[model samples]
Target: MARESFAIGTVRIRPGSARALELPITRLVTGADVTLPVRVVHGRDDGPTVWLDAAIHGDEVVGVDVIRQVMGSLDPKAFRGTLVAVPIVNVLGFMTGDRYLPDRRDLNRSFPGSARGSLAGRIAHLFMTEVVAKCEVGIDLHTGSDKRSNLPQVRADLDDPRTRELAEAFGAPVMLHAGIRDGSLRHAARERGAIVLVYEAGEPLRFDSYAVEAGVIGVRRVLATLGMTDEVSEPPARPSRECRSSGWVRARRTGILHLDARLGQEVADGERLGTLFDSFGKTLNAVYANRDGIVVGRTEAPLVNSGDAVVHIAS
Candidate 1:
C-alpha cells in the first residue's frame, strides 16, 4: 500500500521511507529561524503509530543520542507502522544548555499548551497537535535535571494494565510507578487515551553510552511488542525491579552534602545514604533513607540547604 503524505507548515514530506523534515517556527531574537526537527519512518503495511520524543528538557542530551542512533539504524521496509522521532523538542533551551526555555519556562510543564502563549507553551502545543495527536503510543525520553543523576528507568502509572504492559515492554533496568504530574506530556497523552512511557536516564549535559544504548534497545523492544517490527533476540535480562512508590529524601540541616550512595544502589531502612558537613569539616547531620528501596536518583552537587532533596528512593 502507498503511504500517506502530510505537511507540517511549509515542510512537505512523505512517510513510507525514512525522511527528515523540519517544521518552521517564528524567528527568535538570535535571528535564527526556530524549527522542530522530525524524522519519520512509515512502513508500507498498516500498524500502530509510535512517536519517540527526546530532549523535552533541553539539557537532557542522552535521549538525543539514542534517537539519532535509532533513526540511523531503523529500516522502514522492515517496519509495519509509523515511527516519528523528534530529537530536540525544546530548541531554545537546548541551544542554551539549560532545562528551561529562555523565558524560564519548563517545556515539559507546558504540555497541552496554548496556540497563543509563551514560546515554550507554543512549542508544547505544536508538539501535542502535530506530533503527539498523530501517534497511538509515545515514548518521551528524558534525563536527570540540574546536577542530579538518574539510573536508566521507566516511570509510568503502572496501575493501568496497558501502561504497565508498555513499561514492561520498555525493558528498562527499573520501573517506577510514578503519579502523573499535571501539565506533563504523559498526563496529557493519557487524557487523549494514549499510553506514553517516560524513560529517564543519565544527567543533564552529559552523554552516557550505556544509557543511550539501553534506550535504543528499549525503544526497539517496544516496537516489537506493538507488532511494528519483528521480535529480535531478547534484550539483556532486566535488573528492573518495579517500585510501587517513590519520593525524595530531603536534608534536614543545611550543610555540604556527601553522598555515600549512587543511582541504582539499594538502601535499607535508616541507612546512611549521605552525610552533611559544615565548612569546618565537622559533621552536621547524617542523611538516611526512611524506607528500604533503590536509589533511582541523587543530587551530584555537594552543597545542600535544609529541606533540599538529596536522594530519590523507590520501593
Candidate 2:
C-alpha cells in the first residue's frame, strides 16, 4: 500500500516518507551554488500543512538543533499532515557565524522577498513562495540576539483567536503579545493567512538545554492542538503567564556589568537588577528595574555601553 507523494520544488515527497533536499538559492563567485537545505515529511493521512523554520538569523543556532531533534522524533506513518522543516535559512551567514548577511542586511527583516532584489531579499522571496505559501501554520524559532538570553517564551499577536490558542498551546513559561514587525517573517506569513508564532529562548551562538527541551515540547503540543499529530501523550501545561506589554532596561553608564537578576525571575519596579563597575572596583552605576515584571531577557555579556539594553521585563 503506497501512500501519495507531495510536490515541493522539483521533488515529490511520498506520503508516509521523508526526504532531504537542497533548494537552490544562488551561485557563488567560485562557481559553487549555495542552497537552503530542507526536510519534508509527508504523512500517511491528510491534515493541515505546517512549517517549522529556524536560523533566519544565522547566529541563532539553537533552533537549528531544535528542528533537527523534532524531525528525528517524527514518524511520517504516524503523522497526520505535512511537515516542512528549514533548519538554516541564511546559508551565508550560518557559514560565517554572522547574524546578518554579507550585504549587511538582516535576513529576518527581509520577508516576502523580491526576485530582483538583494541576496537576503531573494532568499526571503524563495522561502515565502516555496515554503510559507504552502502552509497554513508556521512557527519561526529564534534566540535572543547579541549576548542576551531569553526565557522560554512565545511571542505572537494574540489578538487573533487562533494565534492566541496556538500560543497558549505552546506551553512556554511565558507568552508575550508582541506586535508584528515590518518585513518580518511572522508578518509575511500572517499576510498569507497563516498563524505564526515566534518562539524565543536562549542566546545567539549558544545552546541552552532547558530552552531546547522546552522548544521541543512546545512545538509538539502545538502539533497536537492542530491535529497534525497524535503522539503528544502528555497534555499541554497550564496557560502561559501572559504579558501584554514589555520594555528593556538600559545601562546608565558604560562599564563592566555584574548581573544579579536571571531569566524568569520576578522583579519589582525600581529593584536593583545589577551593578556596573569600573576597573578600580568602583561602582559606576546600579541598574534598576523600570517596571514590575518578569525578567524575560537579560544580557549575558559583561561589557556594556551607555544606554545598551541590559534587561527585558514583561508585565
Candidate 3:
C-alpha cells in the first residue's frame, strides 16, 4: 500500500506532495494574527521523517536562506520520507530584528513549551509538539550572536555513534562535542528520544555566501546520509576535526579590539591572537590564545569590555 498522508495541525499532505502552512500562535498588540510558518514535503517512498529548523533567535537568518535553497533543490516526486521545515520560528523577534521575543525571553531556551504559558514558552511547546515529536531527527540551524562570526561547524554530543556519523557526514570544518543545555530544544528533543544536530555558522543579521553554501550542502548531505534523498555532494576537501572540548578566550582590557587570528587558524598556547588599542595607539593589552586549538569563533564588534569573550577555540 502507498504511504499515508503526513498530517500536521489538521493539514494532510499526500505522498509526493508539498505544502506551506501557518499555525496560529497568537495575536499581536495591533490585532494582527501571529503564526508559525511551516513547509512540508512528503516523499513518494517510505523513509525517516526529518525536520530543519532555523531562526529560533530571529536574527540568525542564514538558515532561512539555507532552507529555501535546499528545499528548492528537492523533488517531492523523487524524494523519500517527509521534510518538515520551520524556517522562521521567532516571527515576533524577526520582525523587529531582535534576538529575543517582545516578552524578552530567549525562544530557544523555552523548549517543550506549554499551552497556557508565556509567549516564548507557548511557541516552544507548539514546536515541540507539532514538529519535533513527529520527527526522528532534525537540524537546528544557528549563527554566532552578539556580533561574533563562526566558522561553519556542527555542535552535538559526539559520543553517540550514530550522532557522530551524522555530524561527520555533514562535513563541517569542526565538529564540537557540546552537551545539551537545560531548556534548549536539543535537550527537550533528546529527552523524547529524538536526535538533533546544531549547525553554527556566520554572524547574525548577515549572509555570508560561504556559510550559506556550507549549510545548504550540509543539509543535503545529511538527507542523503539518512537515506531520505539521492542528491548528495562530495565530502568537504578537508575532513572535519573532531573536538572533544572547546573554550573561549576573553578580553583582558577594555579597548578597541584588533584580532590577528582568522577563523579555522590553528594556534599554539599563548600565541598572541590580537591586541587591545588605546585612543593614542598604545597597546592596552595583547590578547593571547589560552590553549592550542583551532579558532572557531571570534567577536566582530570593534569594542569589547574586559573579561568579554573574544575568541573561541576548539580542541
Candidate 4:
C-alpha cells in the first residue's frame, strides 16, 4: 500500500520526502508574526513515528544544533517512518535570548494546553495536537539553566522496560530515573502512551562541543536501535551510570563561589566539594556533600547568594 501524506499545518510531505513548514503563533507588538519552524520527513516505509524537539527554554541552544545535525543527515528514501522535528520551540524567547516567553511564562511548564489559553498554553496545545499526537516516541532536548553546566545525561522513567531499553541505547554518561513534573511535555506525552526521553547536557546560551557530539551520537544510536536508519551505532567510551536519586547542593552562605568539584566526579558523603569566601578572602562557609553521588551538574557563576543551588549530585 502507498503511504499516506504526513501533514502539519497546511504542509504535507509525501512518502520518501521532506519539507519545512511554519506554525504561526501570536504576533509581536510591532505587528510581526512569530512562527514556530518545523521539519517533517515522511519515510518511504512504515515504522514508528518519532518526534525530536528542543529549546523549550529559549536560552538552551545546544539542542538546536543537535536537531540540525540529525535532520540534515537523514535521507527519507532510506529512513523508515515519520520524523517530526522542531529545533526551536520558543521563537520569541529564542530571538531575544531569554529563557521564558514575553509574558515571563515557562513553556515547559505549560503543556497539554488549551487553544484559548495563554500564549504558552496555546503553543503547547498546538504542538501537542499537531506534532506529538502523531508520534509513538519523543526525545526532548535541553541544557542546564541559571549559569549551571550539566554533564551529558538522559532522564526518563526507567521502570518501564521499553523506555529503559531506549535510554540504555542513548549512551549518555548517566541515565537518571526521574519523575514527571506537572504540566510538562514528558508528563503529557506519557499520558498519551508515548515513550519520552529528556536529554540534558552543556549550559544555556553556549554550545559545548563534547556535549553536542555526545547528543548527536546518542540520538543517532536511538534511531538505529529503533530500526529507523542504519546510522552510527558505536557505544560510548564508558557505560552510563544508573542513578536512582539526585539532589542539588546549595550554598550555605552568600559569597564569591569557588568550586573544586568536577563534573562526573564521584564524591563521598561529608566530603568538602568547595568553599565560600568573603570579600576579604576569609572562609565564610564550606560546602559538603550530604550523600554519596556523582557530580552531574554545577554552577558556573563566580558569585552566589545564600541558598542558591551550586552543584547537582546524582546517585
State every prediction's TM-score relative to the real structure: 0.95, 0.97, 0.99, 0.98
Assess candidate 3 and give its TM-score to the true structure.
0.99
Question: So what's the TM-score on candidate 1?
Answer: 0.95
**lDDT against the true structure, each candidate:** 0.87, 0.93, 0.94, 0.94
Report the candidate with higher TM-score, 2 versus 4: 4
Candidate 4 residues lying further than 4 Å off, grouped into runs, are none
Which lDDT value does model 4 have at 230? 86
lDDT for model 2 comes to 0.93
RMSD of 4: 0.9
Q: What is the per-residue lDDT of model 2 for residues 1-315, given as tens digits with 9 covering 90 to 100?
A: 555688888999988999999999999899999999999989999988899999999899989988989899998988888999999999999998999999999988899899999999999999998999999999999999998999999999888899999999999999999998989999899899999999999999988998898999999999989998875776656679999999999998999999999999999999999999998879999999999999999999899999999999999
Q: Candidate 2, clashing residue pairs?
A: none
Tens digits of lDDT, candidate 4, 177-238: 99999999999999999999999999999999978998999999999889899856487778
Best by TM-score: 3
Which stretches of model 3 miss by more than 4 angstroms? none
Q: Write one digit per residue (lDDT tens) for candidate 1, span 37-140.
A: 99888776778888999998889999999998888877787778788899999887888898888889988888889999988789988998888888889999
lDDT by residue for model 3 (1-315), tens: 899999999799999999999999999789999999999999999999999999999899999999999989889999999999999999999888899999999998899889999999999999999999999999999999999999999999899999999999899999999988989999999999888999999999998888999999999999999999884757778889998899999998999999998999999999999999988889899999999999999999888999999999998
**How many clashes show up in model 1?**
0
